[model samples]
Target: MTHGRQGGDGASDPESAGGGASDPEDPDAPTPSDAFGALGGETRLAVVRALDTESPRAFSDLAEATDADTTAGFAYHLRRLTERFVRQREDERYELTDAGRSVARAVAAGTYTASVDRDPVELDEPCPLCDGDGLVAAVADNVTEVGCGDCGGTVLRLSLPPGGYAARDSDEFADAVDAHHRRRIESFDDGVCPECTATVSARIEPAEDEADHGASHRDDEYVPVQTVYECETCGADLRCPVALTLLDHPAVVAFYHDHDRDVRDRPIWNVGSEWRERAVSRDPWCIVVSVRLDGEVLVCYVAGDGRVVDHRRESREEPSARADADDSATGTHTDDSTAVSTDDAETVRANDTAESGPAES
Candidate 1:
């Protein structure tokens, strides 16, 4: 007889199908449809909800909790959910499995509800784009969004957990949502994922569909641009501005800190204009980035191999001999290393020999 086939005598054979019982780790195991079908019946769903309590309930207690008219009907439903949604303890009590608890929570959170009202509240922060004082926080369709009334810019938008809305006041909730986004961006800038610790890569690219996609902020009225970062392992990506990514660098943080400015204190869109890129040389394929801040401009030259070749900072104020002297004394005007000086203009070549350090990646 062929293996896994019936014998000519019609007698059962145990050795044909691997000579053993079915294995849970088999490659051809059943799909998730079986688990989903287990919850299809109303009675089974009711049993799952009844067992989602803090403590396990006895079989009789569960039947009563579900308000089944007869114990036989309740037992039938419980049997259908057993080992899938409902787990039976040694003491003959039933409780929800992790899957069962998740379904129960979804039901309780009104995941299937047809509609929800938007909860709107006023915020105290000003709009970075329009300098307007009309920032509002609202939750609609489970997403929490912060927007400006004057310029119609959607400043911050994020989705919260099912029950996250009722957990805090509006302001606190807004702060929590923004904090989560900030942490994600910072983690991406640092070349890793905050949640999974996976390595990431970043690049600056123009926003798609310029006519449809306005600038980063509403008041800018220019083509939108974005700095995109993607995790090499997880396939997760984040999009922001090139300036924002630069602000997360340690060198930029120290530079602004020395100028009596805290980069973290201001919204990213308000810190500087969007970075402008240009091809400085075609034969050598050199690219440069120009970014304008409050009273100074920064120019960074990058070679074709993607290394930073040079960086220069120019102040709007006139050059001062005393300021230059102090900057040189502090080793800030050195041509070889990454340092900033108070002179009218200071250039630092990537090959400089000063001891401070190279520009941060």
Candidate 2:
């Protein structure tokens, strides 16, 4: 009569028997029941199977798919599954919670790979704070009010997922991270005035004057060491140092921390070599830009504890601004004028209105 144990009849009620408690092969190990009592019933199993497939399904969809005896019946099972952390709902949609999905996928995959097996950076479970499904599609346009089917919760603003692409460990990985960081730093330079752009040049340089490091003066005085590039086009006379904004991205942090031995205690300390290699191994193309064109070019590094600073202006023309402009103009707009004739015109009108507020009446 226990919730999970079966009677001697050999054909016990599926509801009473523990469903996902443990591997049938290993009764003594930690079972799904120990984590949550979700794997405990037939109806709940059906509910989970339904969610595992196309998710963000409505309650009606679940009823239709599962052929539940009643909506109340479906709700009963869903509630129980929820109590066991098997599923979640967002607004009207129902989907597996992260824990639910993780388990569901494990069961589905037949052989679940342990977290240790993969690059430590590859895992991003549900939002620990809010257990919404971690998967989200990136939209070039603005997104609003996304719902998590598992938790039935609504997120008012949708954020782009952390750049999750990973770099494999190889000769090329270091080059890729360095290249990505360079592109991000160059992007910051492109946004500034020509003068600062020339000076910033999107590169980090050690202060030429040792006096700038405060070594000439008392050691107690803090002298700025890292230099960021600034955009001269923005009329900023002073350029700022490139900040490591990628650290804010959890995936990027994992790349460094997970591959700790490779980056730390290096024989020859080359940020370009060791850090870049480590960065790419976590997730390729994970750079985040956090530079602004203040009076002085201001850039914040985001790879670790985020920080801000100013850089010296070196010149007026940024090294790569022209190439970026050419790429923007030609790369994505091959047939711009022809393509904008019909639907694009309407979009242009809407955009103009959004930007200018009807020409100020």
The best candidate by TM-score is: 1
> C-alpha displacement of 42 in model 1, angstroms?
5.1
> For model 2, how does the per-residue alpha-carbon lDDT over 1-361 read when each residue is reduced to its tens digit?
0011234674544443344546557666556556655566566666677788878778777777775688887788677666544544547677877767765665554432221111112112343225555412222221212334455543222211112122233233223333443444334434433322333233333334675554453311222333344332232222222223233334333344554422222211122211210110101111112221211111112221111121122111331343355347646322111111223223323433343321110
Clashing pairs in 1: 336-352
Q: Where does model 1 exceed 4 Å of error?
A: 1-34, 41-46, 90-92, 108-116, 183-204, 210-224, 227-238, 242-361
Per-model root-mean-square deviation over C-alphas:
14.5, 24.0
Q: What is the lDDT of residue 281 in candidate 1?
A: 38
- Candidates in order, TM-scores: namely 0.53, 0.23
Clashes of each: 1, 49
lDDT of 2: 0.36
1-361 per-residue lDDT for model 1 (tens digits)? 0111234686645443233433347656334566667777777877777776555988877777675678898888888788577888998887888878978987777665533335788777677668798878788876776788889988656665545555576667766655556677778767786645777776545556545655333211223345667655445666754445555555556556667776676543344333454432323333445554565545565433333446666663422343355466864442222122322122323223235544554
